[model samples]
Target: MGDLERELRDLSTWLETPEPPDVRAQVRERLHRPARRWRPLAAAALAAVLVAVLPPTRAAVADVVSGLLRFAGVSIAVSPEQTTPSGVASPLPGQRVAGLDEAQRAVRFPIRLPAKLGPPERVLVADPDPTGACRVATLLYDGGALRVDAFDGRLNLSFHKEVIPPGAEWVEVNGDFAVWVDGPHVLSYVDRAGTVHKESARLAASTLIWQDADVSYRLEGARTQAEAIEIARSLR
Candidate 1:
């Protein structure tokens, strides 16, 4: 729990809001409809307006919170309407292939390689800031069948979100918090500039996400929780 998140959680409790109308049907109907995405500036402004008030607007956030699951740098909210399993995977924002040296050079955080997975078949970096520092680094194994993403815990994750049914498991990685999402889940990624890159939205593989040393690691494609933890433990 970061200080800011804790503060925001506390703030949510003080808001008084009436019940918002049930728009699940409306939302579900629009699920298949193509709609324009709000610009980042406009979206952020709308969020500020909604959160600043204490009515149905605040209730809207509370509704999401009822099913929200967050840890480390990842956030997952259970979706109201089940989406079709994701199609093909696509590159994220500013994503590019790199060698280990280049990947390490692109991000400020320390990169951990899983000993069990050995040398990654591919290394990728994405979301470069103005200074050329990327926000996330990914190491792919079995040609991305199994992979891990490493990023700073304090920034750049607000753009990522996931959706899963109930029953995500909670565990500990080397005494630190960890979570296991065992089934297909809807995934969405939007960059800092508000670009929802290619088809980053998809039903991601079963994942094991853990936090350590102020950095968050999201390990996807693990077949079992124990196997995921073993691989995570091997990060060095």
Candidate 2:
């Protein structure tokens, strides 16, 4: 057995021993001889002895001691390094394309298009996910290099657990508030099951997120905030 386990076992064994007759008599005598300045110290010692001797009390004390020791030097880092998942960052997988009409039939929300960007090169629809139990549709422009993701809910993610990067700016998009995070920030999302999705962690494009009514949108691949705002304004 390991040293710690062996020591615990030995302590348990020693605590199980019955007090000798003389020891019991001495304990009784000490209890009777009270009211002195050392009486509080003696009572505390007696309580400790009781805790060590009783099986239930000893087990409880051991649990508390072990827990405190285990957490002594452990520190949880909440910085950028801790936000991204451990595995090699991978690209979003299995993204397929469909026509705008087909995508509209598949998703639960209305799709908005940017007049400036014109018709998208590809329309990608995401299956209903557990996080929001709603479908997400993506409009890919510029040969699928630029994307606008439209869904039916809010992106309520905590900055501590998700990658919001170092600089997050709040701005207005078509009279609605939006958050712009510069890339390549770790692209992570929490699903309905509260699980983290980091498949797009290594993407280099900037992102702009905004909401209107029940619909939310995320525009990616803009070179600057002004360009993103202009594109967002074009969304109808």
Candidate 3:
């Protein structure tokens, strides 16, 4: 019985009483320390989001140039043989004539004419006269041995061979096709198929055609046949 009482007393002593108030307070502070440490991390995340929402600082000109070069399938090589422009350069070759200088505008493209075809002299915009607006450029090749006429815009192309008689309107003669631009002038050309190809566009329309042989083209943009004749006379 005495041994049992001693055992019970030992157990009671082993079972500790409640902690002191100061000790309990210290434990609570330690548990909350981790929460306080996470406050700065939350602020840093918000700052990163603000920065991502801001716009860029510089314009993308390089991207534009790269796209043009890729679409053209050509590379620009600056050699010592070429000359630099002194000021704002014109789009068309300087040597060609502009019949409608007052109304025409110029634009540039990175295109090179064949050396055998000589060089382009000028490019002009054909407008106002009802033969559908056209973007036209002329090339005098081989020192007058060849003349290349390029007309750009939406065109209806056909072929025939017949030299129309003078004073006759839209007559087919000589088995040569003549392009009748809703106006008085007519363009004529013969192809390898012995077929003549004719193309015409209305005022405000554009056309592009290229030929390697000697061809007689008619400019129909002039208000009168005399004016159309004068435009043709200026070709080469």
Top lDDT: which candidate number?
Answer: 1
Which portions of model 3 miss their true places by more than 4 Å? Answer: 1-96, 99-112, 121-133, 158-236
- The clash count of every prediction, one per candidate, is 1, 3, 31
Displacement of the residue 92 alpha carbon in candidate 1, Å: 1.0
**lDDT of model number 1:** 0.67
lDDT of candidate 2 over 113-158, digit per residue (tens): 9998999988887545544233568898887678887866533321
Cα lDDT tens digits for candidate 1, 1-236: 23323333344433443456543344333333333463323333333543545342112232323566556656667765557634476677789999999899999999999998899999999988999999899999997789898888766443345555653656667865577887777766657755544365767778887777768888999988899999999999
Segments of candidate 1 deviating more than 4 angstroms:
1-65, 85-89, 193-199
Q: Candidate order by lDDT, highest to lowest?
A: 1, 2, 3
lDDT of 3 at 53: 29
lDDT of 3 at 174: 28
lDDT scores of the candidates, listed in order: 0.67, 0.54, 0.28
Between candidates 1 and 3, name the one with more favorable lDDT. Answer: 1
Candidate 3 TM-score versus the reference: 0.21
* Candidates 1 and 2, the one with greater lDDT: 1
Top TM-score prediction, candidate number: 1
Deviation of model 1 at 198, angstroms: 9.3
Score residue 34 of candidate 1 by CA lDDT.
38
